[model samples]
Every structure is written in C-alpha cells, then in structure tokens.
Target chain A: MAPPEVHHLFHHPIADHSFSADRGTLAVARENNVELYGKTGGKFQLKDELRGHDKTVTGVDIAPNSGKIVTCSQDRNAYVWEPSPQGWKPTLVLLRINRAATCVRWAPSETKFAVGSGARLIPVCYFEEEDNWWVSKHLKKPIRSTITTVAWHPNSVLLAAGSTDGHARVFSSFIKGVDARPEPSPWGERLPFNTVCGEYLNNTAGWVHSVAFSPSGDALAFAAHDSTVTVVYPSAADQPPKAVLSISTQVLPFMSLIWSSESEIIAAGYDCEAYRLQGSEQGWQLAGSLEAAKGRPGLQDQREESALNMFRQMDLKGKSSDDTKLKTVHQNTISTIRSYEESGGVVKKLSTTGVDGRAVIWTL
Target chain B: MAAVNWRTINIDALDPDSPANFDLTSLAPAVAPVSTADVQSLAGHIRQLLRGGDSEGALRGALENPPYGADERGKDVHLATIIEILQSIRQSEMSPILSRIYQSDGGTEALDVLMKYVYKGMGHSSSATATKQITPQATGFSQVHGRGGSEGGGQAMSVLLSWHEKLVEIAGPGCIVRTMSDRRVV
Candidate 1:
C-alpha cells in the first residue's frame, strides 16, 4: 500500500470536511467559520471563507452533483452556499431547531438535506420554490434525546439517525411535492413524513455515535459509545429484524463511521485510527486496523542515544526520553471520515480529519 | 380575541429536559425479586461447588441470578461469594472460563452482573482503606511492629483491580457501561 497523503491545514481542529464531486474543492468546518480550499498546484489552498455562525460550526457537506455546500453550527443555524459569479452566496435555512445543530448531510438527489440537532429532533429541509426560501418539516416523534449523526439512504427518502438515547432510528423523510414515491423495500411501502420505519436499541443501551446505510440501502449499521458496532437487517416494515449482529472491540468508542460497500464499514474515533469491520447479515467481525505497521520515531531516537546524550537530555529537560509524539499517523481523535474516491459502489480511498488539524487520504 | 403570537412563545421551554420527562425505573428489566433466604441458599450452593473443585460451576452459579431486587445486605452476601470464587481461580484459567461463559446463553447479562459486583467490590475496598487511614493512628502503636494487615488489604485491592481489567478484556467496555447505566441494583 502507498503511504497516506497528509495535509496539515492549520492548528485548530477540523470538526468536519467534505470534498466536491470532482474532488477539486474541500469545505471544512473550522471553529466559527467554514473554509473553502481549492486544489492549487497539487495542494489545497484557502480560496474563501463563509462566516455567519456565532458558535462552533459542527458539520459541512457538499452535494455531489449540484456542488452546493451545506453547513450547520452550534448557533442553531444552517446555511446553503451556492456558487455564483461574484462569490459563494449563503442562504439561511429555516431549521426551526432551538438547540445546536450537530450534523448535516445532503441527499443523493440534492433536492433536500437532513440536519441532526441537539433539540431532540431532525428538520428535513427542502427548497420552497414559491416561497423563495428553504423550509423544513420536523421529525419529532419518538426521538428522546439529541441526535448525534444522520445518514441518507440511496433512495433519498429513508433517513437513518443515531441519537444519545441509545437508539438508531430510520424515519421516512418523504416530502409531498419534493420527492418521488420511492420503490417499496424492506423498510416500508407507504412512506409518510416522520414514519418511523425501524427503531433499534443497542444491546447495552449505550449512546449511539454514528450510523450509516449500505450502498443498496437495505442494511443499517451504527456505532455506539460501548465500543460496539451493530448491524441490522430489517426483514420488513414492522416485523422483527432478520438479524442483529453486534461486533464488540476492545478499543475506544467510535465517533464516526462510513460504509465502504455493502458488507464493509470503516469507523474511527477516540482511538485516532480507522478500523475495518467486514461481514454480512449472518455475522460481523473486526477485520483489523487500517493503519500500517510502522516503526516509532521515538524508537529510532532511543536506538541512536548514548550515555552522554542521556545525561545531556536529563540536564536539559530532566527526562530521559521524549515521548510527546504518538505512534499512529493521527495524533488526536479522528472526528470525521469521508469517502474520498469511489467507483462501482466500492470506496477506493478515504479522507479523514482529526482534532490534530490534519486531513489524511488513505488508499484501500 | 387577539391573534396569538406563536413566534415569541419559546417552543423549547415547553419540552425541556426535566426530571419529570424521564422515568428511570421504566428502564429496568422485569424479573422476579429475590429474597434473603434465596440469596443465602444460592451462596451455600456456590460454596459447595467451589469446595468440589468446580470453580467454573461456582462462577456460573454466582452470576446466573444476581440479586437485582434483593436488599443491600443480601446482595453483599452474594457479592462476597463471587469475589471468593474469582480469587480462587488461577490466572491461566481465567480466559478459558470467561470465553466459555461468554458463549453460553444469557452469558452477556451474567457478565454484566459480574461487572457490577466487581465495581462495587472495588468501591468497598477503597472506602475500607479510607476508613483504615482514620483508625490507623489509634492502632499505630500496636501495629508499628507488623504492617501485615494493611499489606493484605492492598493485595486484595490489586486482585479486584486485575479482575476488573480481565472482565473488560473479555466482555468489552459495554459491560461496564451497561452496569453503570442499569438502574437495577445487584
């Protein structure tokens, strides 16, 4: 495998990041603003900044087809940035959420988006052509706590959300005039707004951190605070699931996860390393860490150290060894993992941003 | 009547995260409550299993039906039996026994119950040391010649900590989280 490409953009943490369809532009949520970085001379260079939110920006996602950027912030606000001749223009969305918005994701069709918020509800926003504004309808029933993450199904109608209440729920976000009637699937046939298609609680009832749908939209997987990843295959609309496989690992809890294909999921979080889990409805197990084994830099320094150097180091810093750096590529918690490139429903490369202010691209 | 100003109504205030909104007792699983006599008999059975060199059976008996609904004294009695069984097992046999227990039916719940007792035991031992500190001065002159009592306490504490670590290795941190969040006492 080739070495991962690392980009240290700044010192501050990156809460989230998204790449444009052509992968030429990157939108990152940094502190209170969203920074747009364009590929210039094979490197990402800051091109513009969108400053509107008063608090920390939590999420940023770009529509794959329309090239539109949607960002959510802790200020209980979200904005849709549309590119124009002058510059990128911002249009405030009527989320109608009182608490901070935690995550945002655009539907595959680009006609709508979902914003997960701390207000114990999700506001599915769509364009209102006659009103000349973006309006939202809330999915409020049965959500007992703040939503931590949200994912869009392939059909763009069914939405999956993970919440602090330890439930990963799938709700139909179908709008009357916005979305076409989706084909019947295992989730449900009569899709209505706020129709809870499935509600699954983790085995230990730990806080759900992230959720994702398979490429076919037939399966759902969620990572919880118990360091367990559970996969659910719904048999039908209202029946018991065919299988619920829980894969527990002896690692720190995952904060974010993405499905690489129908049977493989890549998750990263407090461990600062992405781990791959591969299986089907029958079972799932942790394949291994995606990080390649590399010798530690500190080990080399210790090998080169001598008695004189040890005494000099003790005199200077009163410590025999310098252990500030970590062994892994990422130094802190990996906050977000996005599919950098994919073809034929199989992700080839992944991009991850960490609290250490570095965005790394890894090839599978 | 004047038209109501809905925009200024503060919708969040209507659905605040108040204590009344959460019914924690509802989270407990429905199980038959255990009595003091039931706990004493089960403890006796576990001790018999341990005496017969069936440590695994003793562990299973101790973990199978934790006194989730028993009184504090009853639960403590059962916990003591469990701690004794845990201490009697050899380090080399811990992993195999844990793996077998995990593969059995209702094993996850049993492990969760064990984890709860392990944590409670650690808490008691630590608090016991705290109280020991206060009484040590009173008995300092008598114990200055021999520090065996405190050393034994420290060794027991280490044993409990290692058991906690081994339980996490086998059951994952989910067991600990579940035990902490579960409202039912053991």
Candidate 2:
C-alpha cells in the first residue's frame, strides 16, 4: 500500500476535522478558530479561517452533498457556514445551550444537524424557512452528562451519542417537517424526537469517547475511555439487543471511531493509530491497525563511533539514550478520525488528526 | 553489589553530622544522582511494561521508585515523566492496580505523590492557572464549579481531575480525597 499522507499543520492539538463532498476542502478545529484548507497539488494549502468563537472550537463538520460547514465551540455556540459569492458566510444556530458544545455532525439529509454539548443535551437543529434561521429542539430527558460524540444514521433520523456518563444512546431526531417518515428498522418505527431507541453502556462503564452507526444502520459501535470498543445490535424497539459484544483492548483509550463497512470499523485515539475491528452478529474482534508504524529509520546505521553524540544527548536530554522519535506516524494522541474516501459503500481511506497537530490520511 | 555498597556508603556520608568520619580512600560522592535521562529511561521502561499488559511490573516500577517523591526532582525532570506514566494507565485496568497500591504498605504516600504530579502536569497544560487549587485544605467538589462529578471526556485537565476521583474511589474516603484532612506531603 502507498504511504499515508501526513500534513503537519501546526504545533497545537486538533479537536476535530471534516472534509467536503469532493474532498477538495478540509476544515479543522484548532484552538479557538476553524481553519479551512484546500487540496492543491499533493498538499493541503491554507484557504481561509473562520474565527468567531471566543472559547476553544471543539468540533467542525462539512455536509457531503450540501457542502455546508457546521462548527461548535466551548463558547456555547454553533455556527453554520455557507459558501457564498464572497466567502463562507456564517449563520448562527440557536442551540440555546449553556455549556460548551463538544461535538457536531450534520445529518445524512443535510437538512439538519446534531450538536452534543456539556449542557447534557443534544440539540437537534434544522433550518426554519419561516424564521430564516436554524432552530434547535433539545433532547434533554435521559442524558445526565456531557455528550462527547454524536453519530447520525444513514436514514438521517436516528442520532447516536456517547457521553461522559458511560452510556451510548440512540435518540430519534425526527422532525415533523424536515424529515420524511423513516422506514421501520431494528431501532423502532414511529420514531419521535428524543425517543430513546436504545441505550447501551460500555462493559467497563468507561466514559464513551465515540459512537458510530453501521453502514446499514442496523448495528452501533462505541469506544470508551476504558480502552474497550462495544458493538450493539438492537433486536426491536422494546426487546433486548440481539447481541452486545464488547472487546477490551490492551492499548490506550480510543477517542474516535468510524464504520468502514457493515462489518468493519476504524477507531483512533490515544493509541495514535487507526485500528480496525471486524465482526457480525455472532461476535466482533479487533482485526489490527490500518497501517503498522514503520518505526523511525537510522537505527542500524548508528556506527558513527562518536562518544560526542551520546555525551551531547546526555548533557542536553539528561539520558544516555539515542532513540529520538516515536514509533508512530502521529507523534501524539489522535483526537478525531473521519472517513476520507469511499468506494462502493465501503470506506477506502481515512483521515486522522491528533494532538500532535498532524492530519494523516491512510488508505485501506 | 559492590557498586550498591559504594552508593550506600556515599549516601551515608550525606548525613552532614558524620562527614568528618568518612573514609578518605572512599572518594564516592554523597547521594548517587540519577540523571534526568536515567529517570526518563525508567519511565520509558514502565510505559513499555504497561503497554505489554504487565500491570504488576508497571505498578512496581512506578510505586517502587525510591527517588520519585524526592523534593529535589524538578518539574522539568522526573515528576513530568511520572505524570505521563499515570496518564497511560488504562481505565479498565486502573481500579485493580490502584487498589493493589492502596493495599500495599505506604500506598497512600505513593498515590499522593502520583496525584501531585498529575495535578502539576495539568497545571502546566491548562491555561486556567489552577495549579494551586489542590492543597491540603481545598475541598474536592469546589474544583468543579457547579458541574458535578464527571471525568474529563478527553481534555488533559479534566483527565487529571478525573483520576483524582478514581484515586478516591479505590482508596476510599480515607484516600487521596482526604488530602485536606490529612496533609500527608509525599
């Protein structure tokens, strides 16, 4: 396989990242601003910066078909950026949340979106043609803690959120006008807003870091701070899930996860690499990393025969050692991973951003 | 064993009152200094042990380090490395190891040292400048500022604070949470 494209943007942590439909535009949440980069030649060049949030910008997402960008920040605000003749114009979202907005994602329909927040609510936002702005209805009945991550089903009605309370919940975001009647699925029919379709906690009761719906939306997967990834398959609306499989790992906690296909998933986090888990209703297991780190070169050729380098290292670093670089491509913890390229309903590539400030794109 | 004896002989000289009784032929300096590099290498070894699922080994390495809680260790040196090692403790395995440490002799002291380093690291990473928040008299709930107990979902500061609560859990009411009640300065 070809080597992953590594973009060392800056020496600051990346909270979240998103790519446009054509894969030409990329949006990254860096500190208090959202930076937009355009793919030019083989590199992503700076295109623009969307600066409004006073606090740290936590999440950014671009709708595939609509090309609209939605960003949320710890400043307790969410903004929808539209591409216009001049530039990307910002439209305020009436999230009405008091705490920091932690993560945001556009529904598959692109008619609405979901914003998870520290306020312990998921704001299901949609455009109101009459009001000429986006208005949000809060999903606040059962969630008891900060919502860390949210995922939307392919049908655009089901919203899955992982939270600090160690619960991964599926709520229906069915708006009366914005959404058509979603077909009956394993979750439920006649889905209403804030309907708790399913709620499954991680086996270890860890703070759920991320959640994802299967490509078919029949199953759900969540990664937790306990270094465990769980997949749940709902049987029916009120019945127990057909299967609840959890695979705890020996690695660090995974911060984010994505479905590569119906049976495979990609999770990345403190481990600093993307790992794939594969299974079905019977069971699930970690397949392995997408790309095993080719450790830093120049190990065997250290025959310079100089005590100077070692002494310099000892004097400067205070250690009598020589290994200088990390074994992974991303030097620090990975905070976010998004599906980059897809082929025939399966993910072909993935883009991961880390606290080390590098965005690496890996081919499957 | 001779080198260890020599180091002990030197440390025995560290007692300022007995300096004149030192053997002139034994030119060993007082206190075998572990360079910043040596401490870091030990931390790296502990990190590998944790990653390899050798929880007992990693715990022993961290909790058994004789020089870890020494006052001479600066912020840029061993303390930061210890904090890094603590951050790598997977939450799934955290309870058992923490309980084991609590059950061991001087476990409270070891945990207090670990907690202090975590807070110090958090203070460095966060812009809030709340390093002084965790003192012997400070109440634990006051740090939340109305947001009730919840672990940091991902942020560094929150992660540090979250571990404090975890430390309190396995170690119980008489553990790190009682820092203000009993200021056992590690």
Q: Highest DockQ, which number?
A: 1
Poorest stretch of ten by lDDT in candidate 2 chain B: B177-186
Local error of candidate 1 at A104, Å?
0.8
lDDT against true structure, model 1: 0.87
Q: Which residue pairs clash in candidate 2?
A: A318-B37, A319-B37, B136-B180
lDDT of 2 by residue, B46-163 (tens): 7798789775667667656635323455335565556566667666767788778766765655665566556556656653344434445546667664223223423667657777
Model 1 chain A lDDT-worst window of ten: A294-303
lDDT of 1 by residue, A1-364 (tens): 7777788899889999999999999889999999989888868999999999999999999998889999999999999999999898899999998789999999998999999999889999999999988999999888888999999999999999998878899999999989999999999999999999998876567788999998899999999887789999999889999998887665778888999999899999988889999999878988988877764232344466788989999999999878887777788999899999999999999999989988889888
Candidate 2 lDDT for residue A233: 93
Tens-digit lDDT track of model 2 for A272-343? 778889988888877888765453232334457468977887999998675665667788899999889988
Clash pairs, candidate 1, are: none
Model 1 sits at an interface RMSD, in angstroms, of: 3.5
Docking outcome class, model 2: incorrect
